[model samples]
Target chain A: MWCQSCREEYEERDAGTCKECYEEASETEEELKREIDDLKSKVAFLRLVSPLDLISTTDLLLHAAGSSSNANPNSSPSTALPCTPAVPAHRAVLISRSPVFKAMLENEMEESRSGIIKIYDVSYDVLRSFVSYLYTAEVLLDEHMACELLILAEKYQVKHLKIFCEKFMTSKVNNENAIGNYAFAHRHNAKQLLEAALSLIMDNMATLTEREEYKELVEKDPRLVVEIYESYLTRQVNTAAKDSTLQP
Target chain B: MWCQSCREEYEERDAGTCKECYEEASETEEELKREIDDLKSKVAFLRLVSPLDLISTTDLLLHAAGSSSNANPNSSPSTALPCTPAVPAHRAVLISRSPVFKAMLENEMEESRSGIIKIYDVSYDVLRSFVSYLYTAEVLLDEHMACELLILAEKYQVKHLKIFCEKFMTSKVNNENAIGNYAFAHRHNAKQLLEAALSLIMDNMATLTEREEYKELVEKDPRLVVEIYESYLTRQVNTAAKDSTLQP
Candidate 1:
């Protein structure tokens, strides 16, 4: 057992009261647990609504309680419940059958001038993934998608989306396109994306230069030079056999 | 005009050759501008589709190109477009109607939640102001809303939302509920919120002991002692005013 007051280790029997000090360690532990539970409840209650929600709710309550004559239409119908009827199957079918939907599904690339959502002159397609995630809460991110989304998120000024995309890209960084992505992120001022991509490239500098593109990429990010030198020695030995076999 | 490369101020007569520099800075500047424009175009192109849209587009492309033999209609169509058109409009209506909106319009509130939308486990009415901001992109967040939103953002694990709320709350820290909010943020392990709230409380501590709740809160976070002592003079004056008023 542990003395709750001082956080000292003690035998189970001696935990009730320290014979040497006569401290109420065991009693304090119970009280601490209760206190912790109380704090947890308070935290939970506070967590249930954000400051925005609290303010809005308070505003809503005040509006509802105020004279109806002065109440606005938006606030007047605030009490009406959301319509919860199931989305009709025919509506779903109609959505799928729509010409615009068919064109999107058919892979006929649409022009930017086509009346569609645009943020900072970015195409609607790029923002589509983020919007989709917001609506359905599902994400299917890949290396290219991750890189593109991070840029889109940054351009749109969606901080949460940018962070999420950066995190996703961080995990997907590999020998394939880490350098290119890092350079692109750096140039575009996608700081988080750049840092993550650089870290990934730096961590795997050994197997990188086997690819010609990676070698060129390494020159721009000079921090990868030390790791490249170390990996070159081992790689030379492995490639020596192939060099001799190819000798005509 | 200034040389873009060397930052040398020069007259138009010195255009062709700079006596100090080897390369013409104008050429470099033009090249850089062209590069910037190209990057902007690329960014714009990438932003057109979102990750979700990209995934669907990729799937559509693969199927259309006859590269993937297992092109199932059900799987492809369902994941294509993520959001409903009416969501943004609904959000706009919600924001225009809220009391927080009224308060903001009347300039009763200062800063407000921007861009980010917060989710909560409370009544939809509670989320009115937040949702409204998402739709109309305008809000006037007060001190109370700021603090409450910090708690809510932390609870929901919305990083960006939490950051914004904490920032707003931190700016409003006077001798009032700063200590209480600080303690609450600390207890809840909202590090950023705690830091911001604590810094505010610590800056004005003298009046802290007047409120038993604030005193207890300060006791829990003893780091605020220095600020509390500094504010003691202000607290004394306020106390004197109360005492003189009571005598009359």
Candidate 2:
């Protein structure tokens, strides 16, 4: 018989779905595509023009603290990184996108009154991207950028960008980085990344201790290492119980 | 054999695709659904809090003209529609959503200088819904609301909202209202609704002239009626040509 989709011949045992089902599936696919197009347009429509361009109405300036600045002299000029410029943003956009910003800007906080926010441990580039994401819901992410933005996203309670960064980082995780990622995930409350890292760590439990990250984790946070061992033991007990049931 | 989707038995002749194809298709569907969910989250994230509550930051006021007010006495007090209080909105949001608004706000237009825009030929409720849609990309619509919003959407060049309203109005088009909808669609430049309404009108051409709307349309705009007949004639000629080609 012919497969309606691929238009290739197939044996009876290899058949997938009937003609009626195939037709229905095709229609469903078309409908889904149309819905996606409509949604893409809606997303485009809803996305704000980045406040980066329109500083006329800006209510706040975010400075990237903990970066090299002209005021700081210990860092030599040639080797020192360029000072990160302050990013301009609107209070209304910030409040809408993040609860952290909402609180900071809405309540009579010092930052709200001063209209200046110092974001520590973030470079100017990352700070700019973070603010841009708040307005546009978009960012170009590499693993390094993803990790940086994930931290900022977590700090500001931008759940959408946090999940987006987490998904990217989780997809890039492997045996070498699983232990480190697992610890990072735990610290940041990234449940999805934590599960992915823990699952990879479990699958290669035989070499768990030999890894440099595992030893560092043991020294840094013994409780986390203990939790890993506890999870391994639980899995072993569940497997043995299943084996016993099969034998009976 | 069992149908994988419905889990029901089917004859050999009813088969559609192979097992591999079915698995691939299911995976594709899952991927598409995941994409849809991601887009939905992005839409939600980008969506602004309704400007109604953010009046502190609003830079403009929109008054719905032709609504109940002392300016027009014919609209009696008891029977009159309640005056639509002026809706406050952000200049940034206005400039982002509609090109007309962007042009008006950016070009130092009178409205921009005054920070008050008078929207002619709209009721207060419809104007409120239109502004809410600009902020949230959402509005509940019945057929009447859909038509009214479509007109506003067109006038403002809010293509996304215009398409959304047109789709809703098109779905509600039928034999009874096709002529009226077609005329409305033409006036609004709603291509999708216009096509849907036109097709329905052509299908019922036999009874077209007898309908009261047909006569009203004839008196109101004979050119649109002529276009409908032209489309009907074109369809008839194509059908006859296809039939003659099949005879050989």
Give interface RMSD, every candidate, in order: 30.5, 1.0
Residue pairs whose backbone atoms clash in candidate 2 = A16-B17, A16-B18, A17-B16, A18-B16
Assign candidate 1 its CAPRI class: incorrect
Model 1: fnat (fraction of native contacts): 0.00
lDDT of 1 by residue, A128-195 (tens): 45444432223588776766667655554544456666767766666676777676776567677666
Candidate 2 structure quality by residue, lDDT tens digits, B1-248: 77787777889888888888898988988888988999999999999988877777678899886733345443456633235688999888888899899888877789989888888778889999999999999999999999999988988999888989988998999999999999998898888899999999988878888999999999999999999989899999999999999996
Superposed model 1: Cα runs more than 4 Å off: A1-126, A133-140, A175-177, A203-208, A216-248, B1-92, B95-248
- Taking every candidate in turn, the Cα RMSD to the unseen true structure, in Å, is 26.5, 4.2
User: A243, model 2: CA deviation in Å?
Assistant: 2.6
- Candidate 2 regions off by >4 Å? A67-83, B67-83
TM-score of 2: 0.91
lDDT of each: 0.43, 0.87
Question: Each model's TM-score, in the order given?
Answer: 0.27, 0.91
